[model samples]
Target chain A: MSEFLVLVVPMWVVFTLAAQGTILSGRTGVFNVTQEGVMALGASVGFLVSYKMGSNLVGLLIAFLVGALVGLVLAYMTTQLRLDQFVVGLALFFATTGAAGLLYRQVIGVTMTPPRVDTLPKFEIPLLGDLPLIGDALFVQDYVFYFAVILSLVMFWFLQHTSAGLDFRSVGENPKAADSLGINVTWARTWSTVVGTGLVAVGGAYIPLPFTGIYTDGMIAGRGWLVIALAFLGGWRPLYVVAGAAFFAAMDVLGQKAQVLGLGIPHQFIEMLPFVATLLVMVFALRWARQPAHLGMNYDRESRLVG
Target chain B: MSTMQKSETGPGGSPPVAKPEARGPGILTNIAWTVVPYVASVVLAFFLGGLLIQLMGYNAVDALRAVLTSSFDTSFGMVETLHKWVPIVLCAYAFAIPLATGKFNIGAEGQMLLGATGGAAVGITFSDLPMVVLLPATLVAGVLAGALWAGIAALLLVRFRVNEILSTVLLNFVSFKLIDWVATRVWPDAGAGHPATTPVGDGARLPLLGSAPAMHSGVLLVLALAIFIAVAMRFTPTGFEMRAVGDNLRASMVNGVRTSRLAGAGLVIGGGLGGLAGAIDVAGVHGRMLEGMQSNFLILGIIVGLMARGSMLALPVVAFGIAVLEYGAGTMQLVSAVPVEMVLVIEALILLLLLLSDLVRDRLRSAR
Candidate 1:
């Protein structure tokens, strides 16, 4: 169980960070559907940078910056040009996905064996690490795990407790009203989307660090899409998202470990658990979970429509 | 809302109202207006792609030439492009049909795979059946399976108010595993040395068109489907209602249109077409359901669908263009050592540029 928990924790960080990033932009009315592509780009960039620079930290940072650059384009098109957020996001998704592969192939070339980087080293939390199972599972981890926990808590506090966060969220709920109140709707959206997307890339970057230190195509799988579902399931709340991420991570880890678990069902069916479970959960999640009123809709201040 | 309105008003929108003073120049200019953006976008995308290829240390001119002209240079290339076009166009329909009712069906990949699995199952089970009975059964099974798969998302969207995008996308991952199980466990072909099902009987294969480099009859079927879909979406009342719901959901609801039901139907239909693409591939190309058979059709379909900009008439043409580029991508890689990913990047750039052209045209019109 402790071993399972250890696996689940890192997976949780990926979901939490990605979901939080999604909701961050989502709350600011810039619905970012580029998570899948951005995450792949992040994995590629993160893996490439770490392999070259010999530092995971640098890889993570560069991944964030690269994701931020994509976010900048998304923000410009959706906010300034007032193009459809989903359309622009989808376009960017394709561009980034292709770029991810392009960059990797250009740098690595075709080889019999892919080069690897050292996985992040786990650091024990001194006294806390001495606890039985949970400590080793949760407390004793790499800096990325700690960063994810702290980031989730900080995001929760920032979005729930701060006036700035309220202003930021108002842009998604009612951009005209937010603009009328001098909230700088565009500015709020731009920054949040940039940072939010950066965090998402950081989540992608984290994937290679926890286990395999090499990046491969389709490594993000459908986790990026699941993160979107996670954001919605959690009602775009940071703490709820953290909890939701735990469930997602558990499902993910279980799916990966199904062959070892010796479940009677075929491992393929086991692998389907995360997606099928998410579908089932979504039915119930939508009952209580309410998304930002204007989540995927572009906000036009000059438009006559009420929203 | 504005986005829907803009798409509805774009060149791909409903046919313009005939004016009493309609003349040659007016028609010519209209043709130019429609054609220029597409040409410009493609050219500009190629130029950017060339720069990227050059930077990557490849022969940009040769690569670009290979990408554009490969399909036209040889009979084999033409047949391959048409074969490729079958799935590309069908998948585009899978996407565009749903978009007509304001739902995004991103699960075409899953639907197609399920369709292929469904087709393969029918083909394998009725292996000894005459072609008259088996071929139609295989295709119908595929359509039903695809529809059933998409119906899950539709049911979730309509009954539970779950976001269709999330539901559909998640369903894709589920389909991937489902197909893997089907290939590996249910109908595993041990001799194939890959996770693939046993090949369907001869009766299930699509009839070939020519002596050498023969194209499958599925291409002809899809061509017919393209025409049927174009006419249906443009002239039929149901299509009108679907388009109305997509254009203005509240307005359609106020007018007593069964918007939700139509949206659900659109998704099922889209899924059916997606399934047809899979089934066609099974009957025509692969003869068996295999892992990774879905390829990147989902992405390509979405790209083609978006590029069509809500025009049913434009979808097949755009899909064909994409098919040419896609088929050429392999030749480009062979001739110039440029990665196949460059074409995807170029295709994406074309989509973005085409979208940007809308803004540019809008700006220019307002300035005038």
Candidate 2:
């Protein structure tokens, strides 16, 4: 159970960044569902290079850069094309899913062949690894785990206090007003969207690390949508999102623990804990979760509306 | 609210040059607006696919031939098309009905799963019952289960302003898990080494009619249901109210239409219809429940709904077309070394084109 939360914390950070991106881009009039596809694109890019170059450092770099690139394409499509966000979200879902599966199969072939990866290893702090419980869960972990914690705080500082954060929030609140003040609606959304997608990639890639090792085709397993829900539950608040992630991870862990308590229920349903919890969050938690006013709306610069 | 419509783009600086010359709402015109978008979307999608094939150094003609030849190669291929269309047609109508009233019931996946699980559970449990008793039971279970599941979202929306998309999508998670529980714990088939549920008894199955290439009496049921729904939409008081509420909530409310109740009714009816697809799938096709059974069905439902534009009559035709593509795509896969993920790529291209072309038309309408 503890093992699960430890795994989930980092996952939440990745999702938070995604949620934050939506909030940020909501300011700029873009909510891209291309996260799922972009994450897979990053996974393939990161996995193939890391596997070939046999360097974890290079793999990490590749993951971040490719994530940003996927974000850029999504930003371009939603902002430039004047397409519907819902459809964009669905298209990105299909594109990434099909592309990842196709690419993975092309490279790996029909056999249930396992692709190789020497994951960046986790090291215990000099004395921390021996502590009662906390040490094992947090101190003694992979580079990914450490990075997950740091990134969460970094996202917190970046979004809440930064000048760029103000611009993003302002953009989401009123794009026409933001545009009048020369807020560069397109550029802010583009970059934030890029960062957001990059974060999603990081979240997705974390799945195949020490937790599950080699990647499966549908390894993402709908975690992307859960993150979208989580963003809403957290109200795009950095700390609240963290709490929400913990709640999600805890429910999932509880489902597994139920069997130990001799519930004798279906194990399959038990594993479905996270998904169920996400639904609950969306249903009940959304009331408390604050959403940006201009979220999921497209802004046409050519037709200005002075409200 | 009518006054608020002073500007279509939300309280604007100008009323904008009024240029929507009444495209005299012709029978052909309404039909053209609805039907042409789908054809255009598909064509645009494949055109993009051709570009992709060219990029791959593969002849576009060969790919096109493969896609076509694959869909209609053999009797089995024809059967495959029928099989896919069964649910696609049912689910498309299921989605479109609710959407027509401006309710986004994305929970069709979850609803279908629940209805399927309920229907399958009854079928499997009473495997020994005579067909006379079992068949009705399966259909009833499916409709009731789907309605029950959809009720959750409807209740949430009417009671608490819960966004249906968020709520329905979440419910999908609940249904997915519920099905998993049934598959793994209560009814493990174990016939194949894989983790799947046991197949239902033969008595519960829906039989096919005379040599109709997998077109069972279920097709008649589908056709009957479609026509009935079309008539209901065009002439019924309930249908008119539903449409009115869908088009403008405030207007419908002020006009004394029971907006929330009507929305709830749409949810129930839509959900019941969705579950019917799953019921038919179990009774007409697969004899047992399996994990991830309705996942693809859900996607097809969404695509078909968009293509049909909320028309009950158009659902089956659009679904049949989708089935043909699936059949063709699958057959091509057997002969060619190409992976089947290409089918989804085909679908994505089609949908993307459909959406893009629609955007252009929307722009043109606004521009004029």
Candidate 3:
């Protein structure tokens, strides 16, 4: 159980960070569908930079900047030009996905043996690390895991307790109302999307550091899509998202271990657990998953339409 | 929202309706308006792609030239391009059909694989049957399988209010695992040295046309289907309802249109077309279900569908252009050492530019 938790935690970080990023932008009416592509770009850039520079921290920072660049484009197109959010998001997804592969292939070439970097070192908390089964799994972990925990707490507090957070949330619930109340709709959307997208990239950058220490094509796989589902499953709430990420991460780890578990079932079916479970969960999740009212719709200040 | 509606209405939106005297020059200008943006976007995308190639230390001219000319330079290349066109266009229909009802189907890869698996199952089970009975059975099975696969997502969206995009995308991941099991466990072709099923019976194969490097008859079938789809979308009541729902959901619902049902039907039809692409590949090209057979067609199809911008008539044409770029990507790599991904990047650039062109056109029109 301890070993399983150890495996689940890092995967949890990936889900938590990405889901948080998704909801952050989602709360501003900017439904970011580019997580899959942006995450892949993050993985490639992170892996390459880590391999070349010998510093995973620097790699993650650069990944965040790159993801922010994409977010900037998405924000400009949707917020300023009033383009269709989903369409522009889909287009950016394609461009970034292509760019990820292009950059990796150009930098690494066709390497017979892919270069590797050292995984992030773990640091055990003094008193917490000495506890029972949960101790090693939860307390003794990498900096990113700790960061995910604190970030979630910070986000929950910021959104729930702060007056500024209410102003921000108002943009997604009713942008025209927010604008009428003197809140800067475009500013809220742009900053949130940029930072939110950057966090998603940071989540992606974490993927290479935890297990493989190398990046490959399709490494992000459908995890990026799963993050969107996670956001919905959590009702766009930070605390619930953290808990939901644990469930997704467990499924992820279980899928990876299916071949070795020897459960008398085909490993393929086991590998499909996360996606299938999400599909099933969504049927119920949507009942209470109150997404931002204007999610996936562009806000046109000059338009007479209610949205 | 305005951009999507504008794109659906075509480049300039239904020319003034009251200007009978202006119709003469209006027709020419309308044609110019449509043609110019497409041409300019393509050129600009290529220019950007060339710059990237040069920065990457490759010969941009050679890479760009190879990408543009290779499909026409040789008969084999042309045949390959046409073969690529078969799946690309079918997948574009898979995407565009649903978009007509304002639903996005991102599970074409999964649907195609399931279709192939279904076709292979039928073909393998009825290996001894005559072609007259077996071929159509295989194809029908594929279509049904594909439709069933998408129906799950459609059902969720209609009955439970689940997001179609998430459901469709998640189903794709599920389908990937499902097909892997089918190929490896159910009909494993041990000799193929890959996770693949055995080839279907000879009766299931599509007939070949012309000489060496001959084309398969599936191309002609898709050509016919394309014409039918274009006419149906423009003239049929169901198509009109789908368009109306997409253009304005509230108005459509107010007017007694069953918006949800129409959206569900669009997904099922789109999935059926996606399945046909897989089945055609089995009959015409690969002759077996195999891993990786989906071959980036999902992305190509989406790009083409978006480039067509909700016009069913433009899908096949856009798909053909994409197919040319896809077929030439390999040659460009060989000639100038530029990666195939560069073509994808270029295609994406073209899509972005085309979208930007809409904004520019809107701005200019308002100014005038």
Model 1, span A1-307: residue lDDT tens = 8888989999998998899899999998788999999999999999999999999999999999999999989998878877777877888999999999989999998889999988999999889998887988887899998898899899989988899999988988888889899999889999999999999999998898988898899999999999998998999889999999999999999999988888788998899999999999988986689988888777777677677
TM-score of each: 0.97, 0.88, 0.97
| Overall local distance difference test of candidate 3 | 0.89
lDDT of each: 0.89, 0.70, 0.89
Candidate 1, residues B339-359: lDDT per residue as tens digits?
A: 899999999999888878767
- Candidate 3 residue pairs that clash: none
Deviating ranges (above 4 Å) for candidate 3: B1-25
How large is the interface RMSD of each prediction?
3.1, 5.9, 3.3
lDDT per residue, candidate 2, B1-368, as tens digits?
11211112111111112225645555566556545765777877788777776665556666667777665667766666777787887777667777767777777877788777888988999999999999889988998999999998898888877777677776777777688777777888777465457888777788877584655666678778888888898689998887676657789899999888888888889899889888888888777777777857777787777655445656678788878876666555665556667777888777667656655655765677
Off by over 4 Å in 2: A1-22, A26-29, A60-70, A123-131, A253-263, A301-307, B1-40, B54-60, B212-214, B362-368
Winner of 2 and 3 under TM-score: 3
User: Candidate 3 on A1-307: residue-level lDDT in tens?
Assistant: 9999999999999999999999999988899999999999999998899999999999999999999999999999888877677878888888888999999999989988988999999999999999999999899999999999999999999888998889889999999999999999999999989999999988988998987898888888899999999998998889999999999999999999999999999999999999999999998886677888888777777777666
Clashing pairs in 2: A27-A171, A27-A172, A122-A142, B41-B354, B70-B328, B71-B327, B71-B328
Cand. 1 Cα-lDDT: 0.89
Candidate structures ordered by lDDT, highest first: 1, 3, 2
Q: Candidate 3 has what TM-score?
A: 0.97
Q: How well is candidate 2 docked (DockQ)?
A: 0.42
| Ten-residue stretch with the least lDDT total in model 3 chain A | A298-307
RMSD to the true structure for each prediction, in A, is: 2.0, 4.4, 2.1
